[model samples]
Target chain A: MRYEEFKEGIRDGIPICLGYISVSVAFGMTAVLSGIPVWAAVLISLTNVTSAGQFAGINLLVAQGTYLELALTTLIINIRYFLMSLSVSQKVEENMGMGKRLATAFGITDEIFAVSMQRKKRLSAPYMAGLILTPVLGWTGGTLIGATATSLMPPILSASLGIALYGMFIAIIIPPARIHRSVLYAVLLAVAASCCFYYLPGLKKLSGGWSIIIITVAVSALMAWKFPVSPEDEEDE
Target chain B: MEQIRIGYLLGGIAVMAAVTYIIRMLPMAIFRKKIDNVFIQSFLYYVPYTVLGAMTFPAIFYSTQSVPPAAAGCAAAVVLAYRGKGLLIVAVGAAAAVFAVQLLMNIIIV
Candidate 1:
């Protein structure tokens, strides 16, 4: 029974694995473009299976920002995982022990969480493990390829690839923004705030790490208060 | 290779990995019940979108080392994504747009 569940999880995870490889390739390319070594980029993906958080973290690394900045930015960018962990915790078997819970928790990404939550039965440790396995491997392996291959690519090609991350970011937020007024407001406000941090006199001095943290926290907080998601809207996701 | 300290890069990666792990782990190990606070729930719900949005703009404009190519890419992405194209499509479309614009600019310059 456990093996069956595990196989099912792996089957469900294949599409997510494919998507992850593409995104992580961009990540690897971006890291190398920013002067990070190829091996280091792959290591980051291996250790941290996150997209935005790693992107923000590497930006901090390149800028030689303070450790405090790196930790806080990663924390803020990844805070949504906490909610997913909590929500997914409920769907897991009630008797699930702390050890298994901890192990599965490490794999709770936005995509994994979405897929697992859609399951009709309680999630088991093996299932979560299987679901996480391919995506993790794909992400790390894609990073390896991207980082190594980037040096061989022409400057024009690499330069164009640089826009791929932002393009993916747009793709993530746009659909939610279309369906929800609150999300739309939050995104616009974030963009405006982000621009101010870059172009405004006093704010321009803030490093990219700190600027992202402040804008994300302030904009999200304000939007949450002004337009708390209706329960119905939450169900749509 | 000597441009950056390997120790420094490892330290930064460690911090990121640790923080991300703890966030994912803490909630699952401790919370058996759903968070009932509407404000907190809503805040968490919107956090990812805000972070992605903030990270993308202005920064994206500088992505290709020039505003025109980046802007063209961003516009292409926005249009395709708004039309409900999948992530791979939007990303590749934007990159293609940037490449085309850069090629055009190169032609005009030479």
Candidate 2:
């Protein structure tokens, strides 16, 4: 890759890397508290790059959660990435190969996808590489730091750090909500649906894994079908 | 016991990695051609938000044992987020609120 392009990639990825640092630190702290080894937590942050699923998974592991439980839960949690990947694939430069595509896909978090989608041109491989790499490092590094420091930190402090993931989520949902009425609607609908799931009898008993997947798919799909992105905008992308 | 648990953790990671890679990579690998259909494109575009909403919403309230405090905190978060407060502020605020409320409730009830 050209030096200029490489530099540009780093420049573009700054926000994502910064966000990862905070969120990953929280994940790491939680992992340590959950009785996972520091290295194991780091490995999870490095490999998974998913906050919610990792948090849920760690809790389950501590409880001696079954394999089926873990599998089902994580699957439901990460089901969104599948859809994100599908949309992001469209942004991949047409000439990009399978290996490049796969590598880029690894970095396809909500934040990265949002930023990449806003870019003017099709995302370059070097740009995507830069976007994914720093976040991976930050997440892994943060987890390692949190794990090692868990002993030094008090329980209240550790519990407080758990909020960082939610903070990140809030950060994600707010930006679009501010600009678009549709996004606001989407957030409200999601929140309302979630409450229903919690209150309803049979639904409450459903596994956390499946509940998230089903709710997200149903609500988001309904909205999308109702208010599809205009053809003109699609052409612009 | 520790060794067996460690084995399970590692095994879980391996399995997770494999499944995640496949789900992530399969679409790009299989569909090399441009997706020109409007309906399909729209479906793909909306799917992520749906999935994310589903994933995040339930966790906000039900993940914890006590519903009221967690729910209150999450509700505060949603309102703050709606108002365009920064994410860090909302998160820290909500969590602190939950922790405090729960602590107070415990003290009062006991």
Candidate 3:
């Protein structure tokens, strides 16, 4: 890649990196508090790069969750990425090869996609590559710091750091929820499902992983099928 | 035995990386042809929002041992977000509300 391209990628990736750092620190702290070894926590963050799935998976692992349970749960939570990937495919150059496409897929997180989609032109491979690599490093780096320093940081500070993850989630969800009526419905449905899962009998005992997957897919699919985004609205982007 | 455990952990990481790569890579690889299907395209657009809502809403209220605080916080955040507050403001506001509510709950319960 040319130096200019590399520089551009770094420029585009900085905000994403900052966001990842805050979110990953919370993940690391939660993992440590749950009694997982710090290194294990770091490894999970590095590999998963997913906030909800990793959090749910860790809870299951702590409870001695089965492999099937873990897989199903993570799948449910991450089902959204499948859609995100499909949307991103539209932005990729028409002639882009499979290898580059696959590489780009690894970096297709919510923030990265938001930034990428906003671009006026087709996305470049090097720029996407840079976007993916920087955030991965930031997340892993944040996890490492949080895990290694769990004991060193005071309790209040760790508690505050935990808030960072919630902050990041709010950042992601609120923007779209405000602008789109359908998104608002999806959020409400998810909140209601969570309440039902927490309060209702039998469902209360359902694994966290499964709960996330089920609630997400069922509600999302129902909404998509029933009230599709109109074609006229599509041109708003 | 310790060495074997380490091997297993590394093995897990490797496996996860490969699976993740494949999941992200397949569409880019297999569907080199344009996806002209309107239904499929629409499904792709709306699905991410649903997934995000699913992942996030639950966390707002449920964790090891609290509910009211998170619920209130989420409510506050939702209102603020709807009002067109920037992301940082909405998040900080929600988390702060949660923290404050939790403190109140602790006082009342005690």
Candidate 4:
């Protein structure tokens, strides 16, 4: 039974694995361009297994920001995983032991969590292991390829690829923004607040990491109070 | 460009990895019931989008070697994304747009 579920998990993870390669390739290139070495970039992907949080963390690393900023930014950006973990915990087999829970939770990325949550039956440890392993391989492997390839690429091509991360960010928020007015409002407000942080005289002094945290917190709180999301208001993605 | 010391990078990676693990593990290990707070739930629901929005803009405008191609790429991404294109399509399409613009500008300038 465990073997069969593990096979099923691997099958379900295939699409996610394919999707992660492209994003992680972008991540790898971005990290290399930011002066991170190839092996370190791969290490970041292997260990973190996150997208936005890694990107934000890497930016802070490049800036040589204090460790406090790194920790706080990671906490705020990845807090959504807490919600997914809670939901997935309910779906997991009853009385799952701490070791299995800890092992499975380490792989609770947005994609992994989403796919795991869709299963009708309780998630088995082996299934979770298979599911998590496939994508981590893709993510880390893609990063390795991209980071090593960066030195070979021409300046023009590398420059063009610079926007890939932002493009993915757009892809993430736009579909939801279209579905819900409140999401759109929250995103727009966040953008405006971000601009204030960037262009305003005094605010411009705030570091990029802090600005993101402040803007994300204030804008999200305002939206939560003003237009509380209904249970049905979740994004399809 | 400044060289990133391996030690600092490793430390930063450790911090990020640790925080990520703790966030994911705590609820699964401890929480047996759903979070019943509407405000917290709503806040979590919007956090990802809000954070992405803040990070993408302004930064995206300066992603490329210059602003014009970056703007072109951003516009292409928004249009394709708004049309419900997949993530790969939007991302590659934006890069393609930036490349095309840069190529065109190179030809014109020459």
Chain B, TM-score, each prediction? 0.76, 0.73, 0.79, 0.75
DockQ of 2: 0.35
lDDT of 3 by residue, A12-110 (tens): 667567657766777788887886777888888777777766777677666655556666666655655665676788768888777788778888776
- In model 3, how many backbone clashes occur? 2
What DockQ does each prediction reach against the true complex? 0.54, 0.35, 0.37, 0.54
Worst 10 residues of 2 chain B by lDDT: B46-55
TM-score of chain A, every prediction, order shown: 0.68, 0.77, 0.70, 0.67
Give the Cα error of residue B89 in candidate 1, in Å: 1.5
Pick out the ten consecutive residues of candidate 4 chain A with the lowest summed lDDT: A228-237
Off by over 4 Å in 3: A1-19, A26-41, A52-80, A110-127, A171-180, A204-206, A230-232, B1-4, B63-65, B99-110
lDDT of 1 by residue, A43-65 (tens): 99998999878888788899999
Q: Is model 2 an incorrect, acceptable, medium or high docking prediction?
A: acceptable
Point out where model 4 deviates above 4 Å. Answer: A1-41, A49-101, A104-135, A146-150, A232-237, B1-16, B27-32
User: Candidate 1 docking category?
Assistant: medium
Off by over 4 Å in 2: A1-35, A55-73, A118-121, A152-161, A174-180, A234-237, B5-9, B52-110
lDDT of each structure? 0.83, 0.69, 0.66, 0.83
Give the Å error, residue A45, model 4.
3.9
The interface root-mean-square deviation of each model, in the order shown, is 4.3, 3.8, 4.0, 4.6
Decide which is better by TM-score, 2 or 4.
Answer: 2
- lDDT tens readout by residue for model 4, A96-191: 777999999999976676567546577888899899989899999988987888645577987887787688778778887897788899999999
lDDT of 1 by residue, B23-84 (tens): 99998888766567788777767777777778787888998959999999999999999999
Alpha-carbon RMSD to native, per candidate: 5.0, 4.6, 4.5, 5.3
